[model samples]
Target: MNFTDIDPDKLFSSTDNSNPIMWLVWIVPIVVFMFYGQRIQLQITSGEISKNIAKLVKYKEESKKELLDYLQTNLKATPDAAKKIDGFLEYFTIMPVDFDPNGIIPKIKHLLRSREDYTRQQVKSLSPNMDALEVSKVQNLLEVTTSLHLLHKLVRHLFLTAKKQNNFPLILPLQMMIPFIMEQASALRDAVSALKQGQPIGDGIGPMVVGKMMLGTEKKTITFETVCAEKEFEQRKLYLLKAEGPTATVGRPGDAVELLVLKNKPDIIVMIDAALKLEGEDSGSVAQGFGAAIGGIGTDRFQIEEIATKNNIPIYAVVIKQSVKEAITLMTKQISDKAESVESQVFQIILENTKPNQSALIVGVGNTLGVPQ
Candidate 1:
């Protein structure tokens, strides 16, 4: 023992073959304990998890109470607002299946029924004197809703078919990232709920995603230095205008987009911007909607949208989803497995629909937040 007296050959040659399963027996319990411990730590550290769940519970209770209040108060629904809510809710409620399936339009159509009475009542509460023009806009919105419904249905059907055919791998790693996916979904659901309640959805997710750099308040002729950063938009008819704001803000809001559309008389407008998402989110979960005209929520998006609405121009928005850094790097592929498809959908809207007299304005909206102008 003192001087390596035991025979070296015997020690090296002899081996004990223990069951490999025995190692797991010792490891698994330790892993389970660690996992449970981490969950407890997470619960303590992230109050929002419990608070959000409580909020959901509170929302359900309030929704029930709202129904009761409507019945008791004889509150009427605002037709336009009701229509918007009903349409949004119809599509929002659908559970996503077949992670890669394309069904946005069909799904909306399937879920859309007659506008809820409560929704109509709420709309009336918000806007009592909604005009004929507003009514027409709501009708147009219904068409969009129908298309969304159809898209969802198509996605579901595609997924179902793929499942039957067994066309995909037996295991997809993307499915393993459920908790992250659920977090993003919950964030979206919460935002929508707040919207329905006319409440704020916080400065965390919404402002990071679709809300920024809103244009349009002063009405005048405007122009941008037309630079086609991406080839897909290059061939399409394009125009550019420059607007400088306070150090903290860049790109005009939605109201500006509307004013420009009316004054410049453009046929089509498109906004290209960087959209922020949670650290780990499904790349494909972009929730598109109407934007504001001036400095408000999603104002940048709204500016282009307002112009579209006012001048009867089609407004298409393409948002590159990334963290602030990734956005600067212009990484085409983000976390989603279907990044190509997402990019294609965005690019197609701008490129495929070009006509002889159409002018498209693509706004690269982001925080010129941290970048040098």
Candidate 2:
């Protein structure tokens, strides 16, 4: 056991090379390192993402439950209404509607009618009784609430699935994108609140302008309660089209414009709508361009494009810029104040684009929530 009796080579090579203990000694720490490394990576990548996902999911559930309770208590929704709501919720949650060209308007119309019917039935079951307008407002609120809930639920599901798979690469992009999703969800929540209180949102700027123009003029119903009024502006006959609102609908603008073109054969077609602004763009800024300014499932834009092409009419677009949050939520003072400026810009565009005494069909597109015609 003395230093002189010890041999370094024998001490180091005492075990056979094939010995299992020799392999274990070398392999166990490496395996342990890999396991702990994976855990660390998961913690670093998925911690914030998981927390945000949970927050979003919880918010959606609470919001959905609150809206349902409000419908049942305040709106007096019956069991039948509840079933219909569940159906609507399931449809959206399972298969979200997206932009498509084929028969999208009809599909939207059908959905709207279904929603209206459900709301009507609920209102009918009320003991204290509510008016049709009240029912319409409630229906709109429910729709917004459903959209918000569905959006949050979808994001939460995606995040949870990624986390379950322990996919750090997949999780990074999701984590980066979640803030924007949450922002939109928060805005939608604000929008739902505004709708419940029957307030116009920033996107209603177009309709508000058109509605003001309709005042003191004869309004003719075109389609789906959409109305058009003719007025003379700068020696040209201006036909302004908008949804008959104060209820919640974006009326069938495409159909209205098509009908008007056939009847009046307007020299020019002009459309006004709210457009999403980029980071540098200021809210309420007006931009003039060509083509349909309408935003939806492409049906309306397609219809307008077809009619404009056939009639050889130049289509002009006047868009007011706003952020997504501003577009859906209640109208800001800036948006409201800019309405007149937008109107002036439209007039300028019409005058510059069309010859004097020529007829022009101007359609204001977007939801006419609190805007009256």
Candidate 3:
């Protein structure tokens, strides 16, 4: 009752083990956490990760199903055709040694070309009646399916390893990455539909602009799957280069650029493509800068840069901004509608940069899906 009357000995004494409330309040929690805390936390974390992994699996399976359906319904292929594609999904290529880093682009390009041929051949063999356009579509669709499959496999592998090792730290990175992984997988899933329909994607904005420019002009094949056409604007000769399309292919623009540079001795090289927008940047916004502006395996960019630099030509770039998702998925009305403005910008760049009798090379660098030469 009084400050000095308290029992000092009782305050420091051990708890009464006989009291159930004390055990429930302190001892029980201490014992549980000391022994099974990680197990409980693991179950909680694993449950969340497993839920996302299930979604990833669904996306992968759906893509695979779509491809099989396309094979049967469109190609009129046998059921074994689906099996062949399933086998193809696991195909991979080893990159050439980059230790020296010289002449690696050619080796990389060769390996990529071989892989592309193999992919096209596999799709072609199943349906000899399918045209080149059909083959390109099927090949693109197959790539989307294969990418989803690989993502699913990689995520599952991480999940299993974390579970097996009973290590929460090991799994934390996967947890952090699941959102990005799912974002990409969802985009890949959306792409399957566009590829199946042979619709243009945001990336096609580049080609769409140039394709419109090349329309009603005399066109010639400059390289594999690439075409070039010439036009006169003001007093300058504009040589338009783009992937030959209405098919899902980004042709060898590098070779096309090299050939054109040597042939015409263009005063400037301008490359246009769809670029990824920053977090706050408006989609479909047009931006211009100086560079090759090509987005791919970098071989094209290298070639474009090399030839432009060697010829003492200034390289200019005009880009339409969009997200990776938008670039690969269906061409949004916003992007498709922006092509006209982009074309105007290209013409302006040519007019302001070059003079009479000077030739300008313009490259529409992207997957020219649904955009014809």
Candidate 4:
């Protein structure tokens, strides 16, 4: 066509539907740009997520190595022992059971007890030279290490899947959940530090209080793995029970309490534990109330309730508040410092609720990590 015959107005006019080529000319570049731009975005996002997954894998490996070194140095654990422990750690870390409402506590308790027994047996077999305390320490280290390893694996998997699917929506949710993941990871790291240093964890505040109360007192082995002692407070003969610690175990406190109730027949049963605080609540704040202040599978709490109810014993609970993150991590200065106040409050509760010369069972319900009975 001659240049004079081509009308500039006709070429640019949208109303001119006769020439569909004009429409294609305008639409083609936009479609191509969008398609290629999306591809580029997916590539960049996938690459970034892959790098993060790599870092997490590296972290998990480093944590595993540290745990292995600690086991070897402290427990004199052989390679076979280390391997068994690793397997045990991974088994518990994975926690094959999902949360169920009906009879969940019993199921959890059964699993935990079985796992504990298996782990103890393995530890004993692997580190025959190590004493109970050393075995406990090793177990604590394994628990902390497993938590960190599992967290890393979970986040890495999520990141990889999000990248693989090239789903920005999926990735956005995962990114939003990162803060929670990091919080848990940080707590696990702190827990590892506390376990290695033989320091009390925040969750151990209840046990620490019991330990302090039982200091200089004679402790008797109430169960195969639990201990108890007697203390005189406010004219009331208090029976203090806790897991024999410096190790990381809940130590059959429920079983110990059962034995104590049958033998001592205390008037009031007071249980202390670390409770998860709400967002606004200060960590280490003490609250006094009723019911079992125990955490974990409901076995221990159920035991306490069953025994207490049958015996017609009034159950009182004293709890030290901590964040979910703090509850599992190292004992903060705030939590440690609150121990004395909690003790005082506990004493007051006992005095107010009981008569002089009346016996009371004070059970500290938590993992006795560094607190000794």
Candidate 5:
């Protein structure tokens, strides 16, 4: 074992294979690992994936159970309501073709309206005893259930396909995404209870703040499930818009803004909404920016931007930060307390940007569930 006793001549010896013990102890295993390392990796990762898939299945089942429990306990649904709900799970929509990109917004808008109407009708028919607010919550509950079902089926399909094919590349992506997908599924699972109870979520902060702001002001229903409050704050005319709340819907902020702009002719548009916080960012932080400030498919954002741009109105945004999970789940104390801070910041933005007698349009964008004007 001395350094001087080491043989430099045998260090790179190709003839070392002649030693049976050396070959068995070192070379054989190295050769085996070299040939099968990826296979071993795939097997280990696949095992992990199988465990995650099991968890996903559990979450999916739990969500469906929560839905059925709500139906039976809250709505006194029939015993065979389970069979009726199964049909809602398989509902799918065909997206409008974009071959002609022009006029796509109207097309997409029409489809979205149709989908919402159809879903509402389905929810109403299933829960005839439920009121308007209950109907909205039930519709949202059904959405969460449907999403969990789809998530489980999709992940299971990929898992089986990759396992069957013995394909490492296919499994690699799934392995990497397992953590995120699990987080989303878990969040969705928890959101079921929140939605069913009509609790305010992180996303509701916008509406909550604006709902408070417009407390003494007269409000109008501008569009489908959307509301606008006309108020004068410190010599500035303010047009505040938010989803009509205590109902689980985002409403149509874009249409509301467009209608308000044409009718009232605001000088500046300020939007408030809950934005997704990056990792390590504080959950209840507030940030300022510009533009539509709306989420989802970007159609509504586009509509708002078009109206603002056409009218030469400056668009400003104030955002409350929260994570994806917090947005849908019950409102955290940290996030809920930001309502006051965001309200002050919004007033600051309006005062700093607009002069006295100038009209400012403020739109609070998010689900208004459990928060009312």
Candidate 6:
């Protein structure tokens, strides 16, 4: 059965051999298949890119949400205040760090100098009859604005140095802390703007009222009138000191200040200063106590505190919570709050010491470092 079973004529192969059409049909599909396969691989890579982009968007939105919550919870709002805490956060978050030697620092210095000179000229041109308080307010605004740039440079230096570090220790903590500072700075900017516009200094207290309040604070008030020991209480108001540059020092318990205190013989001396956080302390925590007064260094703060202590005047301190950076950017709120807090404490001290000593001085110390004597 096996030997006779196969018939060659009926079996498998019968062909004329090579055909060009067959080669073309097979090759064309193979080429198309390879091309499609590569295209599909590329599509997979593109899909990965899209996935990463979506993830980045989600991450950014979450970050922004956290920032918003932090600001709203911590900051207070007022109609009179210019820089909302949120504004500062927004400003610093986007600040560019590319340093150029020729770009920033020098330009800021030049602009500040020019602005200062212009302010001096404007003051010189003021009429003798122009309200002195108005003139003084304008001058102070100009000076503060000009001086702020210096503080900004200091901040920039810190930021740049932090960026250059190999290991940025507490980087997240630093980031969290900086936004608070930005808020404070924004508030400062707003305060300066209000001052320039000659808006009322306090809610209901204009500069005139402020001057009067300072003069009327005690039976024997010391001011520009008392600066020269002259009795020009009629023509001269208390708050108007002669025009001095930003660096002019005021709080030094020098003869001028001492004489004022001696004349007043206040029952208590309460000093308020910005206190920085210790290494591991919370940023905005207040510390109240007593310490040495190093004269002549800080803006009249150290000197005045020193003078009060040296005279055996009972000294009390109210230190507001702040970072060193935050302290530099002072809006009126910090100063006002600090001043009121000290004033209240001073009164309390007087009540506590019923039979108190006659002469007392309330010193507002701290980085009076920059304020000239």
Taking the tens digit of each residue's C-alpha lDDT, what string does model 6 give over 1-373?
7968876543422341254555565767798777685544445543443443344334334433432342233222133222332232232222223376445433543454465456545543433333444445444543444334433544445544544552234233444455554544454444453444433322211111122224433333244312221112222222221111112222223333456556554445544455555657654444456653222223334444555666666655556555444543433454334444444554455455435233334443332212221
lDDT digits (tens) for residues 278-335 of candidate 2: 9998888888899999997676788899989998999998899999999988999988
Which residues of candidate 2, in runs, are more than 4 Å off? Answer: 1-38, 72-74, 79-83, 92-132
> Tens-digit lDDT track for model 5 on 212-299?
9999999888998999888888999998899999899999888888899998899999889999999999999999998878898888
Per-model TM-score, in order, reads 0.31, 0.80, 0.90, 0.79, 0.94, 0.39
Q: Please identify model 4 stretches exceeding 4 Å from their true place.
A: 1-55, 92-108, 328-330
Root-mean-square deviation of every model: 15.2, 7.0, 4.3, 6.3, 2.9, 18.5
Candidate 4's residue-wise lDDT over 140-242, tens digit each? 7777677777877788788778777877666767666766777666666656666776777888998899989998999888895678899888788999988
lDDT of each: 0.39, 0.78, 0.89, 0.79, 0.88, 0.40
Task: Rank the models by lDDT, top first.
Answer: 3, 5, 4, 2, 6, 1
* Candidate with maximal TM-score: 5
Residue 205 of model 5 has an lDDT of: 91
Clashing pairs in 2: none
After superposing candidate 5 on the true structure, give the runs of residues whose Cα lies further than 4 Å from its correct spot: 1-21
Cα lDDT over the full model 1: 0.39
Ranking by TM-score: 5, 3, 2, 4, 6, 1
- Report model 2's TM-score to 2 decimal places: 0.80
